[model samples]
Every structure is written in C-alpha cells, then in structure tokens.
Target chain A: MTLETNRQLEDLVAKAKSGNKAAYSEIVRMMMRPVIALTHRMVRDREAAIDLAQDTFVTAWEKLSSFRGDSKFETWLFTIATNKSINYLNSAARRTTERLDDVTVSRVSNSNPEDDMLQGELRSGVMEFMKGLPGQQRAVFNLRFYHQMTFEEISNALGKALGTVKTHYREAVKKLREHALAKGWTP
Target chain B: MNCRECQDELLLYGGVEALPEELSNHLDSCEACRRYLDEISEIAARFRADSDLVSESVDVERFVEGVEARIGRSRVDRLPAVTWVRHVAYAASILLVAGIMSVGLRYVDRDSPVNGVPPSTDQDYYAEEELDEGVVDIVISDFSSRGFLEAGDELLNDVTEDELKYLEENFDVRNLLL
Candidate 1:
C-alpha cells in the first residue's frame, strides 16, 4: 500500500480502462493470488475458486467502464469477488453438490510428523466446523479473522449493516468454538 | 463488570481488537475469563495460521494461467458469434442494395425501349399516316413551315394551304403542333 504502488496500480487501471489487455493482465497477475485465496476460503473448492476468480476478473473487465474511482480498485474488485462467491455458494446446484467432507486439509507443521498430523487434524476439524455455518457467517468470519478486515469494511463489501456483520462474526465465532469443543479440541 | 458481560465483549473483540481498560482489569483478576480469552485467542491464531499456510501453498502461476485461459476462451467463443452477426448484416445489406437496383433497372427498362429504337422514329410517322391521311398532310405542312420540308416536298406537294386549314379545323391538329 505504498504511494508508489498505488500510483502503479492507478496507471494500470487507467491503461485497462483504455482497453489495454496487457495492463489488465498485469493487474490480474498482481491480484490473482489474494483473489483466489479469498475465493478458495469462501467456496472451499479449488477448482470452483479458480473459476470464481477468473469470473471475477472477467466481470471486472466487462464493467471497467462503469468504475467511477469512488473506492480503491482492490476494494471494488473484492466486492465483485465476494458477491460472486456468495452467489455461487447460494446457487441450488452448488448447494446440492457441495460437500463438507470433500475437503482434504494439508498439514504445514514443521515441528514433528506426529505434531503435523495433529495440526492437520485440527485444521481439517476447524474447516469442517466452519462448513456447518451459513455462507454469510462463514464469509464474515473469513473476512474478519482470516483476511483481517474490519467489520465496517466487510459490511460495505457484503452490503450488510455494520451491526448485522458484527453479529454474524460473533455468532460464527461462537459456533466455531462450540464445534471445536465438540470435536474434543481443548480451548 | 460481571464475567458474562466481560466474556461477551471479549467474544466480540477478543484478540481481534484491543480490550478496553475495564475488560483488561476483569481478565487480570479472573482465571476463568483469562482462560476464555486464551481459548478465543488460540482459535483465532489457529485459523490465521491455517489461512497463511493455505495462501502460501497456492500456485500463483497456475492460477494466473487458468484466468488467462478462461478469458481467452471467452473472447474466442464470442468472436465467432459476433462475426456471424456481422456477416449476416452485410449480406442483408447487399441484398437490399441489389433488390433496389433491380427494381430501378426494371422501371428504367419499362420507360424506354430495349432494342435501341427511338420512340419518335420513322415507323411511328408511318403508323400516324395510316391513322389519318389529312392529319399526315397537316403534320407535313407544319413540318414544312418549320423548314423540314426540303427533303420531303415531293410527298406533300399536292396539299394546299386551304386543305391544311380544313385538317386543322376538323382534327384539332393545333394540339399536335404545340
């Protein structure tokens, strides 16, 4: 978020607005990781997350002319990505086909292999715990805890009232902790 | 404040935000609340850690390529449909112009003869002669008055001026002369 980086991004956005595909591709390259990460966390499916990320960029490109520069480009992009992910999750086809048990959590612990397995178990357990919550609550939790976004920003992105977003985060935390305890996690 | 109230505030903010002085004081004196705070902190830490791990594991190149491929395919898919519409429009325009030209040509052909024959030719003069000999005589007299009789005087030399006046009176030859 340096001034120089902001300038560079603005330049890219300007170029993209003028129909420069290369500039847009660079913007995509710069944003693809976080976009995919946010989308992956939301959808919990890699392929679907990739598809959503691609779709988010495609939509952003198609609507580039309508961008009024009222907000940061990243914020605008996140709004589109969040809505797209939420809509996909809410779709009947996705609802019927998406399975919580399909996720295979990988362990990244470097202490010991036994500890790694336990950490992997805990990670997977947390993911499964999160899957039981509603999509909006889970999104709020992801944005708040994982992405470290303020509730106010999440409210703007999700188009929900700030109080409602805070309540969702609180409820999500309560459910997640309860699920973790129910799964024999201490604390 | 009571433990329940402190814990409720902690649940909302906890490790995510700095606790107020009152909540911080409560946690220092209460083991249960301290443990509760620790548990929330641990959960948040674990989630953050897992998120970091997941982010680190993502294949940036693969994701970029996937996005590029999807965009390319979408553009490619739309191009043919757009080109087809354009082609259809062009063909319709060409047909429209050709139809207009054909109609105009038919109108022109109907207005004029097709064999290069002038409408006011010698055959038309002969047809008029068959219609009325006296009318022909007046036509010849009118032509002679216009100085066109030098080549055809032998044919109308017998017709007199009085005969021309009678033809003009009976046949309204003045309309033709005009």
Candidate 2:
C-alpha cells in the first residue's frame, strides 16, 4: 500500500497490459501470497485453491489487454478470484460441501475443549471454522472480516447486491458464534 | 419476540440498532440471547485484529510454472485460428499476384513464343508454319548443297537489273523477301 510499492505495481500492470509475460510473472510472484490465501480460504482445499488461482492468472493474462485502470489491480484480481471461487463452490456444492464440512467439523471438534484457545491455536481454529461455513457465507465473512472490506466492496467482488452481502456476513457470524458455543468457546 | 425471532432480528439488523421494539424487549429479558449477540460482536472484533493468513504449503515456483504452462497452452489453443487466417490471406495474395502477373506477361509479350513456337488461333498454325518454312528451307539447303547458291553471287553480279526485274515478274516471288 506504500506509494513506492503501488507505483511499482502499476508499472508492472502497464507492462503486463502490453503483454509482457515477464512483468506478469513478477506480478504473480508478488501477488501469489494473498491470491492463493484468499483462494485457499474460499475453496478449503490447497490444491483446488492453487488450481483456481492459476486459472485466475491465466484469465487475467488473456484479458490483460482489455484491462482499463479503473480499479486497483489487486482489487480486480481479488474480484476475479472471488467470483471464480464462488462459481467453483456453486458447481461443486453438492459433491464437495459435505465432505469439506466433515473435515472442518472433525478437525474443529478435536480443538482444545477449554473455552479459551491460545492466539495461534485460535487463529487456526478460526480458519477451520471459516472453512466450515457455506460458500457465500465463507466468502462474505472472509472479505468482510479479514479483508476489512466494506459491504459495498464485497458486493462488487461477489457480484451480489449490497443487501445480500450483508446477509451473508451476518449469517456467517451467527454460524460461527453458534459453532463456538457448541465447542464451549467464550469468545 | 421469541428467541428465534429475537436472534433473527439481531442478525438482520446487526445487533439492536434497528431491532423492532418487541425484539429489544426480548433481548432485555433473555440472558442467552444477549450473550449470543455479544459473542458475535466479540468475534468480529477479534477477526479485525488478526492479519490475513497464507498457507505455507504453496510452492511459488511450481505455481508460476503451472501458470506459465497454462498460458503457453492457451496461446497454443488460440494459435490455429490466427494461423488459418494467415494461411487464407497468404493463399489469396499468391493467387492475386499470380493472376496479375499472368495478365502482365501476356500484355507485355502478345506474340511471345513458348519453346520456340508462337501461340496461335483456332487454325493449326503449327502446320501452316511448317509448310511456310519447309519449302524455303529445302530450296536454300538444296541450292547450297548443289553449289548453285555457293557460286550464285558471282554469277548474279554479272546479270543486269533489267534481267532481275524480269525474273521477279516472271516467277511467283511473293514468298521471297525481294
């Protein structure tokens, strides 16, 4: 977010927009962390997340020429990644949702029975909790809570209305709070 | 409002800010619902403090390689269409140029011969050409071989112009350049 870093990023984007693969490669290295992190959170599978992220970049490259500089490149990328994840979730909902829920619930069930968890354990625990939510809720919660994005931004990213994004977030919080209670968590 | 409606109001309105009066009254009397609302608030606050977590298992090099491969494959996927277009354009250009040159070469050399034979019309010009030249060739060759043409310049120099004119009028001489 620093001016220098942002300037460098814009330069990279310009080069990439002109079809510079090396510049795009640099961009991939720079952005891989957050991109993959968001994707992994969305899909709850590392391999699928990587595949989705790869798809995101390839798509971005293919369409780089059409990219007008209206939004931050990362925001644009996050939007694409978010939508791709949502589509993946929607298509695979019947096949994979239950399986993923089982994995997350079982893992969370093995967490410390005590109401309180250490910060590291809590973070991982929350990650698993996030993984357990339904697709829209997971996406809304991740963008809203972790990214601190406004409801408006989440709406744009998810291609949903403002009301829908808020609903999804609230639903996610309710699910988390109830799950925490079931696990004897204090907060 | 009952607990279910109370919780739903809290979720929809984001706590009691826009909760209906009935829901507010329910929350005041219900300790469990109050705790539920408080827990959701606390979780939100806690999430704000933690930074985003990235999985350490992601291999950047491998991921980059995969993207590069996909890009290359997609380019390859798209290449055939462009190549086909180029192929059609090139074939059209070759045909166009060849047609133009064919017209041009014909225009520049209307009577140009191929393999020493002139192009002709409906008649068998080959047979006509052979008849025209065959007699002249035989006369020249025969006269030279008989020593008549070989000795004719000296003999012809002695003849008068009057005699040559007589020969020209008396013999059918139209085929001769004289």
Candidate 1 stretches with Cα past 4 Å from truth are: A1-11, A68-70, A101-103, A106-112, B19-34, B52-58, B69-178
Model 2, range B29-79, lDDT digits (tens) per residue?
999988867876676566444433444456788888889888877764476
Q: What TM-score would every model get versus the actual structure? A: 0.62, 0.56
Residue B6, model 2: Cα distance from true site in angstroms: 14
For candidate 1, write residues A69-177 as lDDT tens digits: 9777887887788889999999999999886434447535568998788778776776677677789997888777765677778899898999999889989888867
TM-score of model number 2: 0.56
DockQ of 1: 0.22
Model 1's CAPRI class? Answer: incorrect
Per-residue lDDT, model 1, residue A23, is: 90
Residue B80 lDDT, candidate 2, scale 0-100: 73
Candidate 1 Cα deviation (angstroms), residue A166? 1.4
What level of docking quality does candidate 2 show?
A: incorrect
Give the C-alpha lDDT of model 2: 0.69
Cα lDDT of model 2 by residue, A1-187, tens digit: 5798779999999998776788998899888777887887787665677788899999888878767887778877888888898888788563555344233223333256653234555656666787678788888877665555667777877779998887787788777667766656655
